[model samples]
Target: MAAVDAAADLLLTAARLPDRDGLVDIAVVGDRIASNGPASVAARGAIDLGGRLVTPGLVESHIHLDKALLSDRVSTTAGTLEEAIRVTAQAKRSFTVDDVRGRARRVLDMAVRNGTTAVRSHVEVDPGVGLTGLEALLPVREEYAPALDLQLCAFAQEGIIRAPGTEGLLRRALQMGADLIGGCPYTDSDPIGHIRTVFALATAFGVDADFHVDFSDEPLHMHVREIADQTVRLGWQGRVVVGHVTELAAIPPFEQDTVVAELAAAGVAVVCLPATDLYLMGRGDDINIRRGLAPIRRLLAAGVPVALASNNIRNPFTPVGTADLALLTFLVAVAAHMGSPADLRALVDTITVHPARMLRLPDYGLVPGCRADLVVWECARAEDIPATLPARTLVLKRGRVTVEAEHRVVERWR
Candidate 1:
């Protein structure tokens, strides 16, 4: 008789999964969800979830690893986005590979501990540094490849398409396996020309395009429309994502709806970065304090696919952040007016399924025949996420327990 397989890696029972309503047990056998059902689901050994909320691990759609590393050395007293950029430019000159790796690893570790399983970070490719930073991060990126599901966007922070020699650098990064081509059109000296050039490069390289566009409090900075128009013209629908659409909220109400409709029709996804926005934009104003977050609720109400991100973690613009979606949820709920229970549940889509679609991640969700990149957030209900932002009671990456939060109470004696 054949021997029964005895070494199952992980099993989680009595979990209140987020995607659906109910308490079910999840089994992870070999790098994917083996099966999910009642506690009776067969496994080598099962972990008692104790009726905690379980959801797919969080996905941070837009972040800058280069700047995330430089955060400690710089501090922005005034807290403006422009100031943060200036600080980063200065700090970038002194960063070594080891320095970048060490700081970035801290953020990633924090993210993993907080149950973020996937991320798409925009790593800048400077003219002098070339792709050294990106190249240095390759092994580390691959090290967490299965667990964290990382995708690197070789971003031309100085405008790849508009700046000389940057186009070649962008192409080389792509050849070196940069997952996406990123741009900062609003910050580019020639914004329109930069957009035109990057769009062509994305086409030529056959990679996805994610741009930091219209990150302005000014209503007149409607580069979002131009991006949508170009995306439609190139038939790059669903392949393009616009991060930080701050202008969408500042625009006229009627025009905002029109822009959303156009973007939705063009198959563009909008990413909102609450952490950095709340810190950077709308500062130095006595009245009319701007929240700086994108119009997430408005976009969702209009049926436009939207996602939330922790853009800057401990970066110059903002000196504090935990790589936790729960915090993002709370801040976004307040800023976007997502007050209802149903609204909160729907918000999970922005962090999970919405970003999966944005990054074209395959089989990312907890279902049959999917990668078992899952986290068991130990909370009772979806709304409970905000109140008790517990670490993943159980974490399975590619169906293996990479890291499990130990439950030990430390008693302090005075």
Candidate 2:
């Protein structure tokens, strides 16, 4: 291998990129990737990946950190979305700053260990929880800055209009350092009004808007159309995201196509929460239960950026989670019927490139000049990521190694 002119801070040798064939060397200068080629580069440190697959670090497009890991404290027999919200609300009544920080920290640790380099977490910002969630997460964000880029979305899990003073609280949260604003339209008395207020805040603050919209087994509240209209009307294209649109699956194919077209035209990205959607939806059916999920393949075919995300972890909403984006990809590959090599590779994108685009992350990728946030998978092929759920051999954030794992198997009988 030929040597580059300038020395690198770190050099990764014999690594396989997802799109490129054969092994290459990645040279890192400061926090950016200086070059990637089949050449040796002098560096202060080096790692021989032995042909392991390297990809841009996974991104969690949408998550709830404030209300995560509450299944033990809250009991839910009905296993419905409403019940989860109600029980979590009751739990929030007893929440303190330390409590929120402790739970959120645990989840963050899990995420980083799983090779997630960027996250967009939605913290509930209603009258019930006040600003406790925001206050706790602000410091956690700073603490995890070296390993993960955490974007805090001031979310209204409860109704915005029905729960008075929520709008003001959201404002204060944004003023204090929230990166974005979010809303739950279906949970409000005036769902459209809630969307309007959320957009208003987003535009006023020059931030993005993420909504938990149309999460049901039926097409009861397809507020996504209104959201798309406002996105186009307010010129917020490419700045809006809608999650858990399982209602799109319940509607007719033609109706779904129409809404999907609108979403594509309006540049609104969609996030499919397979864990929560599959768990909470189709609870009424005795037999032939539906697979409650958004039209992920259709959305992707129509050129809309679709992401698979972990909406909740170990709570009434999901009941179980590992904060692993690869697990979500595996769930969707079966639940959404995406098994082709192309589809499987695309599913990998949902956790890496697609969500990064949705989050509007700057300088993100494995190419030269991009940030050096990368993950080396044990497998050599991208398609095997979802099929095998490969272990992360090494996780890097901004040229700094954050997490490293080793797996060994010894056959005593042999």
Candidate with the greatest lDDT versus the true structure: 2
Cα-based TM-score, every candidate = 0.93, 0.99
Q: What C-alpha lDDT does candidate 1 achieve relative to the native structure?
A: 0.78
Worst 10 residues of 1 by lDDT: 1-10
RMSD of each: 3.1, 1.1
Q: Over 4 Å off in model 1, which ranges? A: 1-10, 19-21, 39-41, 410-414
What is candidate 2's lDDT per residue for 131-182, written digit by digit as tens? Answer: 9999999999999999999999999989899999999999999999999999
